[model samples]
Target: MRKEPLLLLILIALILAPSVQGAKKVVYVAKVEGTITEYTADQFQRYIDIAERNNAEALIIELNTPGGLGDAMMRIVSEIQNSSVPVIIYVYPRGAIAASAGTYIAMGSHLIAMAPATSIGACEPILGYSQNGSIVRAPEKIRNFYTAYMRSLAEESGRNTTAAVKFVTEDLSLTPEEALKAHVIEVVADDVPDLLRKANGMRTKLPVKGKGYVVLDFTDVQVRHIGNSISDVLISYLSNPAIAYILLNVGILGLIFGFLTPGWHVPETVGAILLVLGVVGLGYFGYNTAGVILIILAMIFFIAEALTPTFGLFTVAGVASFIMGSLLLFGKGGGSIYLINRETFSMLRIAIIVLAVLLGLFFLFGMTAVVRARRRKPETGKEEMIGAVGKVVEDLDPEGVVKVRGELWKAVSKTGEIIRVGETVKVTGMRGLTLIVEKAEGDAEWQE
Candidate 1:
């Protein structure tokens, strides 16, 4: 009977042990370094979904940025504010700064922490961009709007609204220690481990609206780190304005060159693929269906022109494609890329178009050179050497001499055939100072 009781106890203990170990808390960590783009926002949302689904104790975003697209930053902030799992924004790795748009994201989190020596703020909106380390403030209207927006975000998160407003209005900056003292950040941690230890048992508001505040216990948490994926890296790269601009130009030029030439369509094939990629890259900024269809038509025309050699037949079509692609890519018509103000976008558009025109003109000269070469006749003796007939002046045991173009030159027989002096041979090709020749099929009169 005693043995039966002991065995029952052991069975119960075994059953409960697994559950106890499995119940350990989870904390999901995502690192963000560089400009906050749409890809970054999307990836952050994905992390939030994973953390919420897994019932994580908290989702920590380790941030280090010099600021990026304002619209992307807003989307990320919105995601954080709406996430069910508590979101903590940590300005990590000493010397990192959450400046400009970064401040807004940091403020939106349920809890904000910073590493020693890190700073945050300096979010003044600029006009166009500060070229060569210069600051050009946006107009008064833009400044007022951002100032109010910053104030509201800080107020909602229970931070110093005055300081936050200064971040936008006066471009105020604060170090980690200063931010902690000003109640802008909850903790000043040296690293992730230190952050967890400092934040353990701390009370933080639930990110979801109307859910109220909850206490976060980071004790013995299982930290799962999520890194950027391959797709995210590609999207981020394509979203770059300069790269997309160069790709579009080069792709268009490749197609034009391929169409002009009559041989193997290597350029045309490469051009078509690049043009499509350029279009997709522009899609990151924003695009419409009509413009996209026109671009596709342009590509079809490119291939058609390649199949049938027509000089400048697709010029109008190619130009149309470039114009439409440029407009859709840079214009603030439907969606947003950076949420940059109208003025800044206008400047960018003009600069890109000017540079593109110069590049096109430069390549136009090259195309003209190719046309000149093709139009020149090959009827002259010097131009007609490759297919001309020659006479073997010296006996060929295989390597001998031949006379062609009114001059004797070193020659090699194609198949090592023996030929006596005075035999006629054909000049197949020229290799440096020597001629590659094969025996003439007919006893035709040689032009020696």
Candidate 2:
């Protein structure tokens, strides 16, 4: 009977062990380091879903970005607003930022934190690019929509709605210290551990489906960062505007090279793939239609230059068009900073101009030289000596001399047949400046 009681106690201990381990708190962390495209939004949502499914204590997003597509930003904000688990947005590490769209995302979180030397805001919406290649702000109605949206996020998160509205209207930016003072951020932490420590015992309201609010207490949280998959990494890399722009131009160049040198399929095939991808990327980032059309026109100018001799006129036009089109590809503060900053734009313009000049030179002088080489009479060359009928000026005991084209060249008989002087022979092959001559028709058995 005592053994039975001990056995039951052991079973209870085994069963309780797992629950004890499970009681250890877990916080799902996602680090969003770049532009928040659709891909990034998906990755972020996935992390949130995982955290909710696992009953995590909280979900933390480490945000550092220059901004991204508005639609993608909205989706991320929506997911965070609807999540049952508390969402914490932290601008982490030294020298990190959460600008533009990032500011809205930060405001959407239940608890917001920032590290030293970090900043938030600059949320003025760049609605689109103007036809003249300037940044166009959202119209009154659209601007009001975002301002109201941001104000609501601030109100719900218990932040300063006035400051949030200024973020949209006046491009208000704030440092971590300033943000904390303005009640825009909840805590200013040095790092993740410091953040969790500061966040401990902090109570925040999580929105329930029908219920009023569920108070979440952040206590004894464990941070577990989610790693990005290969596809996610690739999408982030290609989302860079500079990379996309370069790929598009290189694709155009490749197609030109493939067309100039016919029968080469590799360049054209790769160019087509890259061009399609680049166009898709442009669309994904919501590039202006006018800018895209201008770029296509620039490419046409380059092709025209390659096909015809325009004395660099078409080439000049192509370079000018390329510079303008690139300038307008994405206006300042539009998408990723990597794409449309003044320095990058100027550098890319100069680089593209130089590339266009080099390609133009190749099409004009290089290809012309090749054509001339092909058409020129084969005079004074090895090919010119072939099939020439020459008189055997010296006897050939397989080694002799022949006069052809008014010049005497060292000669040998192809068949080792003896040939006397004054007999005609045909030039066959040349070895080390010596012509191999074969006996020609009507030259056989010439009377000695």
lDDT for model 1, please. 0.76
lDDT of each: 0.76, 0.78
Candidate 1: tens digits of C-alpha lDDT, residues 1-448: 8899999999999999999887889999998877667777888899899989888888999999877767888899899888888899999988898998889899888999999889999999864332232455677998888888888888887888889888888889999989989888999998888999999988774345445676888888999998788887777777666566556656876787687774979988888777777767665654355545554566555555444435646544654565565555443334233234455456656755775465444444544555676778776553477777889989877889999768888999988888779888988877777788888879655885
The candidate that wins on lDDT is 2
Per-residue error for 401 in candidate 2, Å, reads 12
Off by over 4 Å in 1: 1-16, 130-133, 205-211, 261-269, 279-365, 378-448
Looking at candidate 2, what is the lDDT of residue 110? 78
Off by over 4 Å in 2: 127-139, 205-212, 262-264, 297-321, 331-339, 377-448
lDDT of residue 316 for candidate 2: 69
Per-residue lDDT over 346-395 for candidate 2, one digit per residue giving the tens place of the 0 to 100 score: 56557667766675666567546655676689787678877787889999
With a 3 Å backbone cut-off (N, CA, C), the pairs that clash in candidate 2 are none
